[model samples]
Target: MTTVSEAILSRRSIRSFLDKPVPPDLISKIITQAARAPSGGNLQPWYVDIVTEDSHKRLLDLIQTKIASNPTGETKHYDFYPSDLPDKYTNRRRATGAGLYEAMGIAYDDKEARWDAMKLNWAFFGAPVGLFFSIDKFMGKNQWCHLGMLMQNISLLAIENGLATCMQEAWAVYSDTMHEFLNLPEERIFYCGMALGYEDKNAPVNKFITKRENITEFVSFID
Candidate 1:
């Protein structure tokens, strides 16, 4: 059995997935385990919906038209990053993006290639399963944090089971489309999407793992 530490170290935002299908039963099992994640007041905030098989195809077909007409996508329902993000955060984001493109052998000046790569987010990077996460619109940041804990649990559990996942905030752009397709009520606000499946071992985009800051960078000792 894989240890918690192994799952933590091995997990990455997998951008490439194999064509293999993940059984619906396995997906349900991982979600059941993630339900154990701690939540404030046990509100659990997160509402998860998944797409696989024929449903997945239907979603892609619906979105493809929107993609062709407005490749830039709709206005994001929530901010993925602050409008005036600090240099520290900006630097880290840039570093990660650079490493990602480098792994894909995409040149920095190649605008078309970069956009092509970015578009992959809409297709969930070819992952066989896509998970949509949402929370009540009235919830505060605390509840949002709780939702994140749930997602983290899902990520870790997925790794332990030989599945990889990529948390795609890009899905926020088509919030209305997704809400309509999923037949979800307006009270629930779409937050993010996660691509889940077996990794494509030979894909270049999955070749590099992003870096993490040392504990000293953000942690402090009370002593």
Candidate 2:
């Protein structure tokens, strides 16, 4: 019986997962609960595509092939981050990456090792369940924000159900390929992917805890 606050505090971007399969019924229940997340005008702009077992294998193979043929990756349908990240944002990003690499004993200069570790993302970090999120191409930035709320809800609900998740914008680089493989309509644009399952608690990468700014840093109160 995890409280919402506890779930929020405990949830992490789990990069490694155990081999255990998540029951479809459980996934259904999670989604049903997460759907309660609010959207402006109740547009409910997010659409999810679930991959598991054999279908997951097929999607992984297709992604691997694409990666091998075009190691640089494809153009994303939407930008996940700012093109010119300011110093404040870039500094935080570097710190998080450095921490993760240190946890895994990957040296800062080891580019090859880093690339190898990143390749595991295509495999969903061995999670038994993978989810792809998409939205209609016509949706604007407000709808995109709505999608984020839905995703956060799913992540928190997952923690309540003894599951862990990693939201991967890296999947956006393969948007075109995924669109074709999933047979989604041309008007639907891939937003992001999520890995879901029980975390590999013993993995070194799983132990990395990223830092967050103090509440005062971003909050403002006017009398």
Candidate 3:
């Protein structure tokens, strides 16, 4: 049996994907299992939009138009990350970004290339399925945190089945476009998106790994 430890240790954010479709049954099973994730008061407060048709093409079209108008356009609904981030969080974000760019041979000073690279998010990073997460507007940050737990659950379940995934905040950049395209009700807001499929194990970007803080830095135990 695969222990929980084995599953946790092996899960990773897979960015490069092969161009193969994930069967509906498999995708259904994955979501069904991940829904087992615990939520406070069982409000669940989450909804997912699965993209598999011309709908994805329409979404890409809308996003492209927005990006053309403002390459660093304001995210349509909520800001994905803090604008004035603290040192610890900022460093972690920069290091991984640098690592990813370096892997793709993008120069440190290349703004256009970096933004070009970011455009891949709308393409689902070449994955066959794109899943967008949404949450009710009234839910507090605690509920959003619960939604994250649910997302992680989905990613881990994918890993256990030899599939791969990348959870993306980039999708929120086009939330208004998405909301219109998906015809989602006004009460829900974009929380995030995810690309799910088999990894292109040979891709150099898949090899990038950012350092994480040690337990001593972020953990406390009073025993």
Candidate 4:
């Protein structure tokens, strides 16, 4: 059995998945377990819309159509990053992106290739299951933090079950289209999407692992 630390360390944002199907029952079990994640005042602000089989195909089709008609992408409902990212954040982001492109053998100047690679997010990176997370627009930042806890729980649980997951915030760019397709209530705004399934072990993109700052970089202990 995998220990908690082992599971956490092994989890990665898998970008490529195999054609293998994940049983709905297993997905249900993982999410149910993840529901144990704590929420402020037990509000449980997170809601997930699971997509699989035909529904998955339909969502992907619509996303492709929208992308083709509007290649520039849609406006995000929330700011995923600051308007002017601090040097620390920007440097890390650039480094991670560069590492991924390098792993995939994509040239730094290859805009077309980069865009094509990014489009794969809508395709769920060929995962058998996709999940859309949402929260009420009225929720505060604390609620959003709770949602993050829930997602982290799901990711860790997935790793324990021999499944891989990728949390795709890029989906927020197509929030309107997804909301319409998923028939989500107006009050519930999209937060992010997740791809879940067995990893495509042979994929070059899967080999890329981003660097993480040491604990000392972001942690402090006072005696």
RMSD of each: 0.9, 0.8, 1.6, 0.9
lDDT of 4 at 123: 96
Query: 43-100, model 2: which lDDT tens digit per residue?
Result: 9899999999999989998999999999888876777788999999999999998998
lDDT of 1: 0.92
Worst 10 residues of 2 by lDDT: 71-80
TM-score of each: 0.97, 0.98, 0.93, 0.98
Angstrom error of the Cα, residue 85, model 2: value is 1.5
- Per-model clash counts, in order, read 0, 0, 0, 0
Instruction: Tell me how candidate 3 scores on lDDT.
Output: 0.84
Candidate 2's clash total is: 0
Candidate 4 per-residue lDDT over residues 1-223, each given as its tens digit: 7789998888888999999999999999999999999998999999999999999998988999999998776877998889999899999999989998998899988999999999999999999999999999999999999999999999999988999999999999898998998899999889899999999999999998878899999899998
Per-candidate Cα lDDT values, in order, are 0.92, 0.92, 0.84, 0.93
Q: Is candidate 2 or candidate 3 better by lDDT?
A: 2
Error of 3 at 32 (Å): 0.6
lDDT of 3 by residue, 1-223 (tens): 5567877877777778998888889989989998888899998877988987576677777788888887765656875678999998988888888989999889868998988888998788888889999988989999998888889888988888878899888877767777877788898887778999999999988888767688999899999
Candidate 4 ranges with C-alpha deviation above 4 Å: none
